[model samples]
Target: MTAAAPPRRTGPVRSEGVRLAILEATARQFAARGYDHLTIEGIAAEAAVGKQTIYRWWGSKSALVAECLVEGMLLPHRLAPPDTGDIRADLTAWVDAVLTLLAEPQGETLLRSIIAAAAENADIGRRIRESLAGSESIVGRLEASIGTAPNLTPGAPFEELSETLVGAIVLRALSRAPREPGDAARIVAAVLGPA
Candidate 1:
C-alpha cells in the first residue's frame, strides 16, 4: 500500500466535522461492504468529501480504518474505564465492557481486520497493539490503576498481567462460549487476589 501524502493546504484546513464525516462514512462502508471493499473514492463519495481530504488526514486505507475503529468503535470503551478507587471493581467493569464490545459484530469485524493486517504487516500489528491496548497499554493502565508494590513473587506476574488478560479474552472469543457476567470478576480475582 502506498503511503498517502498530505495535500498542500492553500487555504484554511478542513474542519473536524469533515474528518468525522469521513470516519462515519468509512464505518458505514466497512459495515456494508466489509474491509476488502474499502476504497478511497468510495469513501469520498459516501462522505461527500474530496479524496485528498482523507489522504491528508490518514496516510493509508489501513490507517483510515484504524482511526475509524479507534474513534467510532473503541473510543467509548477506551474512555469509559473507571478509576473508581476500587481496583477490583474498576478492572471488573473495564474487562466486562471490553468483553461486551468484543461480542458485537462491529467490534469483532474491527478486531479481525486488525489481526489480519497485523499478520501481513508487522508495523500495523505493533501500532494497533500499542494504540488499543489501553492508554499507554492495557498493562500500563492496569499498573497505573492497581499500583502493585516492587515486591517479588513466584508463579504470579504483576507486570505481564495484561498479556494474560488478553489471552483470556482471545480464548473466550474463539471458544464461542456464552460469557458469564461474573467472567470479568473472576479474571480480576485471578490477576489481583481473592476478593
Candidate 2:
C-alpha cells in the first residue's frame, strides 16, 4: 500500500469544552483573588489552557470577566430571584439576598469591580444589560412573579420598580451605608405597596 499524505489543519479549532473551562476558571480565580489580582497566566494554569488560548478568545481580562458575569459564573451569589408565586414575598426575598451579598466585604468588592468594568467599557455595559434581561436573571424572575402582587401600586411597571430597587441597592453599596433589618421589606413595599 502506498503511504498517504496527512491532512493539514487549516485553523484553530474552537472548543466549547475549553471555552467553558476557561470561563469557570476565570470565575473561580475572580472570586478568590478579585478582579485586580486575577491574572491570565493563573487562569490558564487553572483551566489547563495556554495563555494564547485565552488571548485568542478574550482581548483583555476585563472582557473575560464580563463574559463570566454575563454567563452567571462570576457572581458570589446567584442573581436570580425566587418565584414563590407571590410577588411581594418574592421581591423581598430577592432584595434580601442582594442586601446580604452587599453586606459581605467580598461581595461589596465584587460589585465595585463590576461597576468599574462596566463604566470603563461600553461592551461590558451592554453585556451587563443583556445578562439582566436574560431568563436566568433577576429581571426575568421578577417578571414571572410581578403579576401576582396583590396590591401593586398603580403605574408601577416592573421595569421602573426593578430599577428603583436595584438603584437603591447600588447606591447603598457604593456609599457603604448600613443595611438595617426590614430594609428589604421596606424597599419592596415602597415599590410594590403594602402586601
lDDT of each: 0.69, 0.78
Across 79-156, the per-residue lDDT of candidate 2 in tens digits comes to 777766766787788888888888887677678767877877788877777666655455665566645665343444
Show how many residue pairs clash in every candidate, following the order shown.
1, 0
lDDT of 2: 0.78
lDDT of 1 by residue, 1-195 (tens): 998999886965779889888989887888787766779999999899889888887767777777666553535445356776566687788888878877877556656766665666676657655654555445555656544422213433544676676768777776766888699999877767675
Give candidate 1's whole-model lDDT: 0.69
TM-score of each: 0.63, 0.76
Estimate the TM-score for candidate 1: 0.63
For model 2 the local lDDT of residue 68 reads 85
Q: Report residue 26 deviation for candidate 2 (angstroms).
A: 0.8
Which ranges of candidate 2 are over 4 A from the true structure?
Answer: 1-15, 52-59, 75-77, 150-156
